[model samples]
Target: MFIQNALPQKPNLWKYIIGLIVVVFFWRGLGSIPLIAAMFTKASDLGSIDMTPAGLADLLGANLFLSVMLSSFVLGLIGLFLYVKFVHKQSIRSLTTSREKIDWGRIFFSFFVTILFIGGFLYAGVMMEPDSYQWNFNKEAFIILAAIVLLMLPLQTSFEEYFFRGYLLQGLGVATNSRFWSLVITSSLFGLMHIFNPEIQKIGYAVLTVYIGLGFLMGIMTLMDEGLELALGFHAANNMTIALMVTTDWSALQTDALYVSSAEPDLGGMLLFLGGMFVVLLGIFALRYRWKNWGNKLFGKALVLEEETTA
Candidate 1:
């Protein structure tokens, strides 16, 4: 039923694939414009600015750098919009959910739950190692950072959620005719997308394990719930809380956060916290929604090739 939502749209397989490629190419190319300008400004040479996250942060200034990157996701959103509107001949609503209307309740519930969940992690870490963090708050800068985050963070997180859990999840399910493969493929891609983040450079590739794990959890939420609401809410909350609460030289989002962590990441603690939080969040959703059909929802082959061919 999830992938079948695409049936009425009559999508062309090749067009969907090619269109995404074109959109991403253009969108990413445009995001590079500011970085290009920064390079020239910094050393009077086009290639002077190193392409690392920290390098860009140094050259562009933290706030301007983040604004530029977040704006690129807005472009990605537009590309996805163009594809759904013209190429797929479908409404964004269908891409979002199987329900008659968007589920704001699920979104809000997941959002608040994630805030508390991650808030706990931060508190525990601080309690355990008080000296590891520095209060980085500058009230004027924080107000400015919060303003930017409130406005642009949603666009950044939503762009990723819609593209991954919504658009690509649905697209792959329909393309492969198998929801299980769809979930795995999209989640892997989601993880790999962050492989180039500054965290990888700081903490090494082990952090990718955490990224991929989070991907699977979000993918599970989307597949089992038959909507992007939970995934979108949880992701938005995750990023928003981090952007507001903390930052590090090694983190992907090196913003003017309230607290800055000076210690290297505890890989084991990171995994444990992520895994534990994921299970707890899943439990909350399971009980509240009374989710059923675990064997089928998470792993069942929903779109058989022959069945789709016949249909």
Candidate 2:
């Protein structure tokens, strides 16, 4: 039903291809100008600057750097909306869910549940390995960071969801005529998008399993639930929690979080632990949402009804 929302318009594959280019130009090209200008100014002052997340965060100050970095996504989201509305002739609500309206209830439920889970895990980790974390709370900096996270971070995460889970997922599903291929391609692309993150360098390419795994989890959620609400909420909460609770040298974004971790991440152990947690979460979601028709929803053919095409 969600994928079929694209049926009435019959948007060709080329539209998606060109849409991606437009979104990327807005996100990476136009959006990066401010960051580039800031870096250039900093380079002139320091005679040189390191071209890394940490370096940029340090040079521009963490909050300012983060705001500028996330601004790109805000622009990208705008571009996506324009394309979806005009080029695709699809309503934003249709892109988001198959429901008559956007389900704020589901989004909030997933958001709060994920936040609680992440908070509890962080608390337990801190308790178990006290030496691995250092208190890094700064009253002023944290307030600023919180404001930015509350406002800008959602836009960034939303942009990703709209692109990956919403736009691209639907496009691929209709194009390939199979939910399975759509899931696989989008999930893998989502994972590969993070290949250059600082954490990958610290933890090795094996970390891609975690990224790809999470993508699959979200894709599965989208397919089973027939909406992007849960995935969007989960993603926002996951990043927001990490941004607020913990920071590490090798993190993708170095934030003024409440705690800084010095622990060397154990890749294998982390994989096992996260894998177990993902399974449990999936089970819980399935139960809560009363998900059924697993075989059809996940692997079924994406069919466009004749009536829908005529309408």
Candidate 3:
């Protein structure tokens, strides 16, 4: 089974929530038409919006961050809120699986480990090229920009995480009475959603094999760990570092970063990314969460053929 199917069944509400999400996606993509027609479809301009090729292309024609946020990001959030409040009939605490309430330990552990990982890379980069990275420390301007980005960007990233790995994972698991299919469908959709990223254009579609692999990795973490806390922390750290530490002309999430790497992103970096994610997964597994049915949890069928199955 992919999900435990332990939650109280609520089919009618679930349908409404799903409808709202579809509506949000429709408007978001459709609404981008005007922006796309305005810009010549430049990647850099869209990077400022949310780092996706579609959004960046829109920026190429019309580089207005506010419109993108107002039309797409905010609409999505409002839809999510409606889903949670009206459709799911769930509180934030309930949606997060508050068996013991919020798990601060898991969140902090993942957060601290990510800080160390990113710090190690930064240290290595500095040692390798001291003169390559000049500090961009306009404190006043940066502080304001940082505040704006921090406030806005997390909504975009967190919405993806909660929707794909948390809300969808849990809902589908419950709906199907299986955990396995939840992971498969959720992770597959997550990766497919990124197909239009500018990085795919610059680095080839093969890079997304690793990306799909990552979706599986994070999905496994959510299912095995039975929560999104760790995945959330890791994702937040990964993106926050990219937003604050490095900015590339071809990269998503272009910002006033601390350093700009001259080296092109390569296959080696993709391998390293996969390697690092597995390492973290291994560490979590080593913590002995007592996770069970490893194969079924990740790759098996989600349907519960037997009533006695616990999922």
Candidate 4:
């Protein structure tokens, strides 16, 4: 039913291709200008800029740089909503869920659920390896970071969910008429999108499994839940918690978080831990939602209902 929402629009492959191009133009092309300009100005003042996360944080100051970085997604989201409305003749509600209204309840539930897990795990990690973490909290910096995280980071994560799970998922499912392939392609692209993350350089290519695994987990959640609310909440919480709770040199975004990790990431153990957590979350969601019809919902063909076309 979620993917079928696209059916009434008579989804053409070209529309999706062109739509993506437009969104990316706003997101990456025009959106990057401010950040680039800021970096250039900073470099000119400083005589050289490092360009690494830490370097940029130092150059532009963490909160300002983070704001500029996330501003891109804001523009991209605007571009996407415009295209979906005018070009595709689809409502934002339809892009979000089959439900009559966007479910804020589900979003908050998922958000708090993820926050609990992240907080719990972080506490455990700090206790188990006291030497790995240092108190890095600065009251003024943290207050600023909190404001940015609360306001701007959601836009970034929302953009990703709307693009990957909402737009591309529906588009691909309609194009291939196969839910399975749609999940696979979108999840893979989501993973590939993170290939250049600083974590890869720090933790090695094996870390990609974690990213890909996250993509699959989010994709499965989207398909099973038939909405982006859960995925959106989960994604936002995951990033927000990380941004608020911790920072490390090799991290993609280095901020004045509460703690800084000095320990080298254990890729193998992290993979297993995260993989297990994914399963547990899935089980919880499955039980709570009472998800049924796995065969049809996940792997079955996506058909355009005649009623949808007529309506």
Candidate 5:
């Protein structure tokens, strides 16, 4: 049904291809402006600075780097809306959900569930190892970080959902005519997008398995829920809450958060943690959503008239 939203219009396959390129170009080109400006503001000798996560954070200051980094994603989000509206000639609602109204409940529920599950333990760890966390809180600076996060993370995560889960997933599904391949392609691409992130570089490429795997789970969630609500909310809550709650030397965006992890990456431990959490998360989501017929939903044909199929 979600994929069928692209069908009524019978969009040319090239439209999806060209649109993706245009959007990404604008996203990268515009997003790079801040980083470029930082070369001037953050450097006396730009050539000497390493471009890694900690390196950038050190040069730009944690708060300013995060603010600038997230600022680029804002333009990327706008690019998606513009391309979807004019190029695809699709309404934002159509891009978002099949319901007459977008389901805020699903979004909020996913948000709460994911935060409680992930953040709860992260906070517990900070408490348990009081030495691992140094309170980096500053009243004036934290107020600024909170404001930047509130404004930017939603835009960043929402754009990711709209692009990966909503746009590419549906477009590829229609083109390939198989839900499995669509999921595979989009999920892999989602992982690849983060190929340049500091986490992957820090933890080694094995971490991509986690990224790709999470992409698959999120894609499955999108298909199962018949919308982007759960996926969008979960992503937003994960990034926003994490940025507010902690800063780690290895994280993508190092911010002035309340706690910072001093632990080095233990690949086995990291993988185990991700794999374990993923299983529990899927189990919980499955029960909450009452998901059924995995064989049909994931591997079956794309529905023709979503209403007939869903009904």
Candidate 6:
């Protein structure tokens, strides 16, 4: 597969470790510097970044916060790229899949599919509150904003997926000598990382069941498919839909997206999220991707690598 070719024919454990640390320093540590400064300066509380466009605008204006957040991601990207290119000595494409190149088809297909799915929700919102919706259609600014959001946001989401599900999943799998452990660890960490999200506070801890469930879904898809394509598509679509379709008083990302929605989230409880997740999992299984040794895959031990060589 194209992804296989992208990886180091022989894994280099040291490079992976160093690269992860480098990524964390830049993407996370450096990224938080601005927020930290703001906290100390009393410029603004961290929780102020809201779901509305105006709220997003305020946060973006904070140079330190923006610098740290964006630079950290860039740093992480560079670190991962270097690991893939030099340590693994593999083409960028192989890192994602065994494909020779990025399958624009997969990306677009997922994009459109997600749009259609979320578009349904948007339609419902509009139907419910026709007067509440308004289009601030400035051709030029809208175009630029759309481009920026679509391009940059997807990169951000993809970075998360690659790092957590792809790189971390593989590394942990090799380290623990068990894919199951890797999946559990990766998914758990993924969900835990979002504990600080503003949405949790707005909607309550019940919403986190959805977040963690979503993480598990993404991670499981990666493990079952033996690649990140499906998860990447699903995640990009999910985020893009959220970005473009809705805006609320209490949500995480604030962007000048296409549609400004005012719908209070109904699926704000654990039971709803679990039910939704169960449905999605069933659908995936219906598609016949649920392979043999199911019990082992979800919670089995990972394969251990030799100490001397990870290749």
User: Pick by lDDT: which candidate is best?
Assistant: 2
What is the TM-score of candidate 2? 0.95
Model 5 stretches astray by more than 4 angstroms = 305-311
Across residues 1-311, which tens digit of lDDT does each residue of candidate 6 receive? 22223234656578678868877776787666655665546545556545333454464542223233444555566667776677666665656654456666655655665566556756776787887776644566456556655666677778888788877776676666666677778888887777877777667776666777777887776665556776788788877676655555566655555556565566544456456645654364436444565665566545423553355
Report the candidate with higher lDDT, 1 versus 6.
1
Which residue pairs overlap in candidate 1's backbone? none
Error of 2 at 228 (Å): 0.3
Best-first order by TM-score? 2, 4, 1, 5, 3, 6
lDDT of 1: 0.83
User: Model-by-model lDDT, in order?
Assistant: 0.83, 0.90, 0.63, 0.89, 0.83, 0.62
| Model 1: residue 138 alpha-carbon error in angstroms | 0.5
> In candidate 6, how many Å is residue 275 off?
4.3
Give lDDT tens digits, candidate 1, residues 181-293.
99889889989999888887777888888988889999899988999899988998999899888888877787888898898878898899888977899999999999999
Off by over 4 Å in 3: 1-6, 12-17, 20-71, 98-100, 129-135, 288-293, 296-311
lDDT of 3 by residue, 84-104 (tens): 666666665555543457676
**Cα lDDT, model 2, residue 231:** 91
* 5 or 6, greater by lDDT: 5
lDDT of 4: 0.89
- Error in Å for residue 104 of model 1: 1.3
Range of the 10 consecutive residues with the lowest summed lDDT in candidate 6: 1-10
